[model samples]
Target chain A: MALINLAHGFVEVFQPFNMLMLFIGLVVGMAVSIMPGLGLVMGVVLALPFTYRMAIEPSVILLTAIYFSGTYAGCFSAILYRIPGEPMDVPMLWDGYTMARRGAPAKALGWALVAALIGGLVSSAVMVGLAGPMGDVALKFDSPDYFAAVFFGLTTVVALAGKSMVNSLISLCVGLLVATVGIDSIYGTERFAFGVPILRDGVQLVEVLVGMYGLGEILTRIGQGLHIEQPKETAQKVSTQFPTLRELIDIKVTLFRSTVLGTVLGVVPGAGATITAFIAYGIEKQYGRRRHLLGTGVPEGIVAPQIGATASVAGHMIPLLTLGLPGSGATAVILAAFLLHGVQPGPMLFESPASMLMVYTILASMFASVIGMCLLGFFWIRVVIKVLTIPQGILSAIVVMFCLVGSYANRNSMSDVWMIVIFGVLGYVFEKFKFPISPMVLGAILGPIGETAFMQSMISSNNDWTVFFKGPISGTLMAGSLLALSYPVLQQFLASRRRCAAVA
Target chain B: MTPGAATMPLRRLQAAAPYVVVLAVGIFLYIQADNFEFEQASGRIGPGAWPKIILVMMMATALWGVVSSALRAGHTAPEAVSEAEQDEALTQLPEIYPALVWIAVALTIAYLLLLPILGFFIATIVYTCVLMYLGHYRRPLRVALLSLAIALCFMFMFMRVVYVSLPPGVAPFDQLSYALMAAMGVH
Candidate 1:
């Protein structure tokens, strides 16, 4: 059944319109990601409003193509210009730039491209294998279990934020509070509405996304004087030089290790490509065969993070497709796309032929997108790099315009526009205050699911609070949440103890 | 007191302001959650329960932030901080004309306010041109052409292709919008 569905998906992707969308998505994804300050999440957010008029299949294909290519294209800037196009690309700079300075920019880019292809292809295979069985497992989830899952996602985001845990927690709580602004689902009562008729309808997730990420990012950059340093003259001569078969055989261990690590970490909610890239690079530094020569421009150094980052895209999609939970910011936008099309992407997705076809189409598109990204990166890289010359003022203006129009288009209500601006300011303030934004975004996306599950569990269990702990799954998940919440504090305590011991 | 010592209290207050505001907002919202008319049933939780719980969590975290910030004031040794904590410190951007931020914010709000009044097309072109100019694109002819082209492209894309009903303004501006839409065969 899965094979048949996947065949149909490939067929659907070959349809001219879907292929065009895929092509456009790949180009746009690469372009947006090659520019500094514009990232994968922002690219996905900007593309979302355009998908409003699209079919679910084409829209998902478009966004996933963008997501796939966005992860890989940033390496060009990271390698050549010493500027990371996305945060995930930062890991590339340690070795990619060093290698570029050593007069092998093309070779470094080639390593990245090859690494991305292998990582993306391997993880795509894993995703194809795991997503269906994962959906089947999720089919057994009850209200308490679903609540536990949502609880687990939220805790993981908070725990993994790597910033001040209190600040992350506060950001998450604010997002949860934002989710409660509309009329409650079960009780049919207005929540935090304060008598405004529009408030009763609740805040739309797209508005929050566009506001905080899209407009807020523009505002933050504007605050920094809209200054992005121009790439040096060496960036003009851009091309890719594929590593030889011998070179490929040499780094097989690093490639396998990074791909496996990336896939596993990607499955964890909140551990996105950026985190995966950094951790993979760290592991390579600690354990690579040439660990001593790392950061002095080793091919393994270039391969590890690129592979990890690209591979994790499939890992992130698994949870999104199978469980209706987004493991990262980009996936959350994709989740919004799913909800926008009225296709709930949980276990039931696999039950129906139509939704099943949609899922398979997206998976198939991931393979196509990875190949297409490499093709584009190989031939049209010089052309894509030209976008860097576009003035920051023009880019910022265009972004601001997109934010306003996108928010207004969501509901055709002026209130959403206002909400975007408000949230945009809040986002700028959050950045200024050293708070991480991902937890808040994930919190908002998952809050309603968590709340509904909790409410239903309470009703079914006659308000028995301990029912969550009674079930083995729920109990284990709740205990995980407790551990996640305590991890930072525990780490701090241990660090202080180490300090005291050193002093003694 | 030295100048650094004198400014220290003010800096701490500024740092504490956001948490204080979050605490205040959380308290206010928690109070409003009580206004939900639905009562908790024997088995079912009320609409207010979830939000109240969230608000409580928010307030507690905010309070903790405030207390920690206050407690750490004047005693935070640079050597004692963890590498990760040091890395997490907010890197202050050197503002070239710090007022540009406020000006841009005002311009954004103004543009949105004017969007329905002047229509998306007219308002967007004007807003884009002015913003670009303010952002240091000094050539008038280029800015004008680019802004007009951007607005036209967006207008066609959103209205003609995507079928979004962009703001058509009130009165005279609506007539221009209709004429443009008609010219573009967007009926």
Candidate 2:
């Protein structure tokens, strides 16, 4: 049934409109990922308005294509220049750039491309195979179980929060506060409107997203006073090539390991591509046969991270397609798109043939995008490299304009424009204070879901409060949430114990 | 009485800034949540119930932050050094960048305020051109052309293709949009 649906989806997605959107998404994804500072998340946010006029399947295909391509293209900037275009590209920088500096940039890029292809294909297979069973399990979940799942997603905030967990908690709370400043979802009464007419309508997520990540990033860059000029080498002739067959067989084991590792990590809520890339690279260094040559410049170094990062996109879609839970910030935006189109993704989606076909069609589109990235990547390297010289100041200005227009386009409301500015500043301050912004976004997106599930569970149980721990599935999920929340503390305790043992 | 007493309180207050703000917001939200009314009270959940729960959780986290900060401070001198290094890095940046950022901020505020009045096209053109020039795109003709091109592209994309009702400026500009959009076959 899944195969038939997927095959049917292939036919549907091959239509000119859907394929065009997918191509455009791939190009935009590559461009955005190639450009420094402007991330995959912002790229998707900017595309939201354009998708407003699109059908749900085409819109999702467009964004998902971008998400897939973005993971792969960041390596270009990371290799050619020393700058990693996105956080996920950082791991590639160490090995990819080292090889580039050694005059093997083409080879490094080739490895990145081939690895991304292999990993993406394998992960896509996993997604297609696993989504059904996961959906079946998720369909059994009650309200308490749903609440626990969201709580688990929220706990990812703590795990991803770099250096300061407290700041992450504060940022998340602020987001929750922001989410509360309108009509309650479960109850019809207004919770935090404060009697303002605009407040009653609730703050739009797109405005907040564009404002904080998009506008806020621009402001931060402008404040840093960046002045960039074109590098002379940017005009230098470059040849792009894929690895030979012999070269492909050389690092087969490394590729397999990283792809598997990335796929698994991608399934874990809160562990996104960046973490997967780093872990893949780290695993290769510790275990790969050429460990000594790892840092200096090896294909394994580049391949592991690129493959892991791209493959994780497939991993990310599993939960989103099956359970309706966003596995990363990019997936969260995609989830928002799902809601906008009046489709609540989850097991229910699988019940409908049309919805299932759309889901498979999206998956099918990703396979097309991976091939698209490879084709475009080879031809456009020189042109894409020129974007690096366009000056940070100009880029910042352009991004600001896009943010304003994008926010305004949401509902043609001036209030949304104001919301962007407010959150932009808020995001800037959060950055200055070293708070992780991802958690805040996660909190805002998941706040309604968590609240609705909690309220339902409570009301249904007549406020028993023990319902969350009564059902087997809910109890297990609750346990997982608690374990995730305390994992850092446990890690810290173990580290301290090791230190004491060393001292003794 | 002692100099340490004066400095310690100030330092502690500075360290507790995030906690103080979070706790204050939580308490404020809790108080405000008291007035939330429902037509009929549900058995276990009211309109205010969820908000109150979130507020309590926030307050608890804020308290934890304060306690954790206090507990860690005396043991971690390296954290202070790292913070100092961060401050130094910020201070090392060219002064003009901060100035430019503020200038950009002011310009954006003006743009937003003027947008509804001046309309989308005229306001966007003026805003983009001025912002580009301010950001050191010194070639006047080039800046104007680029700004015009961007504004027209966005206008066509959002207004014509998407059918978004872009804010029409007063009098002539509004008519211009209608004329322009009609010429593009949108009207």
Candidate 3:
């Protein structure tokens, strides 16, 4: 049944319009990922407005393509120049740039490309295999279980976000509070509206998203004086030279280990590509055969991070398709696109043939997107790099315009535009104060789902507080959330103890 | 007191300011949550229940931050140094220009405020040009040409291709927008 659906998905993606969208997505993803300040999440956010008019299949195909390629395209900037297009690519700077400086630029890119290809294909297979069973399991969840799961997602985001757990908690609470604004559905009473008509309708997610990630990012860059150091003129000669078979065979263990690690990490809520890449690189440093020489331009250094980052894309998609939970910032925007199309993801989606087809179509597009990304990366390396030459001022101005226009386009309300400006400032302040944005973003996106589940569970259990603990799955998940919330504090305490011992 | 010692309290207050503000807002909102009218049922939650829970959590967490900041004042522990290092790594950039950021904020708010009054095209072109100039693009003629080109392209893309109903301002600006729309073969 999955095979048939997969085959149908391939056929659907090959349709002229879907294919065009896929191509455009690849190009735009590459362009955005090669430029500094503009990243996978912001690229997806900017593209969300364009997808408003698109069919569900094409829209998703476009976004997944961007997500897939955006992970790989950042290696170009990392390998050729010292700049990391996204935080996910920062690990690439260590060995990818060193190898380039060692006069093996093409070879460094080649290893990255091959690693991305293998990681992407393997993880995509895992995603396809797991999503069905996961959906089946999700079909059995009660309201308490659902609430527990959402709670777990929120706690994981906070635990993984920033140095200070208190700050992440504060940001997340603020987001949940924002979500509570507007007329409440259960009781039909207005909330936090403050007598304003627009507030009664609630704050749109797109407005907050574009404001924080888009306009907020531009504002941060402007605060940094809008300076993007240009890559050297000699660095213009860039191309991917595929690693020899012997070279590939030599790093097979590292490749397999990183790919498996990345895929597993991707499934964990709030562990995005950046964290995966960093963890993979860290693991390789600790355990690789040439651990001592790892940072000094080793293939393991280049391959481990690129593979982990690219492979995590499929890992993220599994939960999103099966459970309607986004594991990363990029997937959060993709979730917004799904909601905008009025199609709720999860087990219910699989129950319908039409929605199932949409699911498989998106899955198949990920495979196609991976292949398309490689082809584009290999052939149009120079064209993608040329985007780095675009003046930061011009690019930032255009991004700001897009944010404003996109907000307006959401409901055709000027009020939404104003909300973006307000949130943009808030986003800047959050950055200035070292508050993590992801927990807040995920909190806003998932708050409503969590609230509905909580309300339903409470009502069904006759307001019994212990109902969540009575169920096995809900109990386990709730336990996990508690652990996640405490992990940061535990780590901080441990570190302080270690320091005190050293001082003694 | 030494200069550093004298400034320590002020620095601590600055560190706690954001949390204090969040706590204040959370308290205000919690008080407001009380007024959300709903009949208390035997076993059911009301509309304000979820918001109150969130606000309380926010206030508690913010209070924790404020207390921590105040307690940690004048104490530069090793753990604190590591935390500072982590924050520095996260920020990535070393230098920051507050004036430039404020100017951009003002420009963005101004653009949104004038968007309906001047229409998408005129307002966007002006916004882009001024932003580019402020961003250190010294060539005015080039900035003008680039801004105009960007505005026209986006106008055509959003209005014609995507069919977004962009604002058409009042009277004269509306006529200009309509004319541009017609020129681009938009109905």
Report the number of the highest-TM-score candidate.
Answer: 3
The chain B TM-scores of all candidates, as shown, are 0.82, 0.73, 0.87
Look at candidate 1 and give me any clashing residue pairs. Answer: none
The Cα error of candidate 2 at residue A408, in Å, is 2.0
User: What TM-score against the true fold does each predicted structure earn?
Assistant: 0.96, 0.93, 0.97
Q: Rank all candidate structures by their lDDT, best first, as comma-separated numbers.
A: 3, 1, 2
User: For model 2, what is the error of residue A364's alpha carbon versus the real structure, in angstroms, after optimal superposition?
Assistant: 0.6
Tens-digit lDDT string for candidate 2 (A428-479):
7777666778788878887887888988988888998888888898888778
Please state the interface RMSD for every predicted structure, separated by commas. Answer: 2.6, 4.0, 2.2
Pairs of residues clashing in candidate 3: none
Cα lDDT tens digits, model 3, A178-238, are 8888988788788888899988998888987898999888888888888876887744577
A478: Cα error in model 3, Å: 1.2
Point out where model 3 deviates above 4 Å.
Answer: A501-504, B77-91
- How big is the RMSD of model 2? 3.3
Deviation from native of the Cα of residue B23 in model 3, angstroms = 1.2
Kindly list the per-residue Cα lDDT of model 2 for residues B1-187, writing each as its tens digit: 8676556656666767878788987898899998888777645568787778778988998898887766554342443354323322421233346677667778889998887777878888899887877666668887788888888888888888888887877786688766777777776
lDDT of each residue in A1-504, candidate 1, tens digit only: 667777898999999999999999999889888887778789999999999988998998899999999999988987888767877887787789899999999999999999999999999888888878998998988999899989988998888885588899998998888888888888788887778877789989998898889988877777777776678784557889999999999989999999999999889898889889988998999999999998889999899999999999999998899889997889999999989988888999988888888889999888899999999999999988888899988988888888888777777778988889888988887877778888888889999999999999988888898989889889988998898889888988998899899989
TM-score of chain A of each: 0.97, 0.95, 0.98
